[model samples]
Target: MALLFEYLPLILFFVVYKAVDIFWATGVLIIAAIVQLVYYKVSTGKIETRHWIFAGIAVVLGGMTLAFHDEQFIQWKVSIIYALLGLSILFGKLLFKTNLVEKALMGLFSSVQKEQEVEINIPNAIFNQLLVLWVFLFLSIAVLNLYVAFNYSLDTWVNFKVFGLMGITFIAIVFTMFKVYKFLPEEQ
Candidate 1:
């Protein structure tokens, strides 16, 4: 549910693009992003930094796409978002001595542990490896988006954005889960 909420704008953009065109789709994407932010703020009382960053980029890039009547800006948004995310992860570790990936993953696991009365102890070394894995994953996806956007047609790019990138992300999640599975306690 929360995951689906995060992808709502992208999903809407893809659907709108398929039904109409890039410009219309871009407008819907912008509106959807704003709506998402508002919804999150209203529901959670505070929106996450990442959500703000994503919404800001969407509005700026989507606005440019609409203002200039060019689809290139919208196409660039995906790569920009991923690049920023990857950089944030890298810098958080290097400058702040904080591992954002580990924090997020641990927060998630903590909630599950509380609910199921299970203790999952993942080592710091494992978290470090996962952090590197995610940074590379995001950077690779950013590069892949740029490659597909420039080398392919708009239609192809849209399809890749909606389906191909999602497929890659899904695979990465599965891979991460497998990597962490050894840390889980054995069933009684």
Candidate 2:
């Protein structure tokens, strides 16, 4: 799946860390991210903003970890990426009056509209609510990552990054689904 492809780098990093060492894992992660990005662009014929951001963080911070032999750089990558994501959502909504959630959903809506033979428009309320939810989600994840990184040992932080964070994100997705379900445009 596309989601799995997006996470290939992280998954590989976790595996490599278990098999070898953080230094080796960091190198693997950097290579994996670059490969993922190339494959994604080739397959999709388009590169998403998030893809660029992910690759950038992986290269810059992961490179630092590799070059300087400091695990801190790698630890900060998630927080930085999350912060940027949160800011992008807020920036889009506030400055451009753009609802990224709505924009993202337009493709699905188009398919539904074609099937139902009706027009569908997501209300502004839904957009605003989703935007706020996403901003909170991103910022919260960033803070949580930092909290774990600062407070825990390297092993513990790596565990948190790989498993704990994914669990939390899964929960957030479920919660967001429940919140947004009511706002879905119905077929007329």
Candidate 3:
């Protein structure tokens, strides 16, 4: 089931007209994502702030794409969102004591027994810094995607859509894992 969810976007693009314009198959995937978000809210009875912000971005940027009738604008939308998210994470964590990523990521660690014990002790600043890093990682993905979509071909974009994002994400994961592993705290 998780595998299905993961590959669903790439599968849709290929099963349809293959991310081609006029059809704007990516738009359909976005729409489906929106619907899933709505259903999640109904079922869970909680709406995360980050998801709301993401929806706002999608609407505004997607509307911009429609209003201007420019594919480039639309193509660039994901990058803008990624860059903005990255910047926000950087600022929120480094300058302020906020952590959008930590807050948005509650579900992942919610089940851990030590989560509650360590939650309060965790440095908000570091979480914010981590958010910044994660967001920048996402931004890298957006930029790479744009490069392939424009300079190469839709097929290349589709291929990246399948593998490129994962590759970049894997890089982040490995970096973080190595950092954590190498920097084990000295127990007092």
**Best-fitting candidate, scored by lDDT:** 1
Candidate 3 whole-model C-alpha lDDT, 0 to 1 = 0.62
Compared with the true structure, all predictions reach lDDT values of 0.91, 0.85, 0.62
Across 15-108, the per-residue lDDT of candidate 3 in tens digits comes to 5535365236546545755765685588788866766765566566556666676555546656776777777777776688667676654544
By summed lDDT, which 10 consecutive residues of candidate 2 come out lowest? Answer: 179-188
Residues 1-188, candidate 1: write the lDDT tens digits. 98898899999999999999999999999999999999999999999988899999999999999999999999999899888988999999999999998888778788678877988888888888988998998999899999999999999999999999889888978887888889976655
TM-score of 3: 0.66
The predicted structure with the larger TM-score, 1 or 2, is: 1
- TM-score of the candidate numbered 2? 0.89
Worst 10-residue lDDT window for candidate 3 reads 179-188
* Model 1 residue 123 distance off true place after TM-score fit, in angstroms: 1.6
Please, what are the lDDT tens digits per residue for candidate 2 over residues 87-110? 988999889988877787667567
Candidate 2 vs candidate 3, TM-score winner: 2
- The runs of at least 3 residues in candidate 3 whose Cα sits more than 4 Å from the true structure, single-residue gaps closed, are 1-14, 17-22, 63-69, 99-107, 114-136, 181-188
- Arranged by lDDT, best first: 1, 2, 3
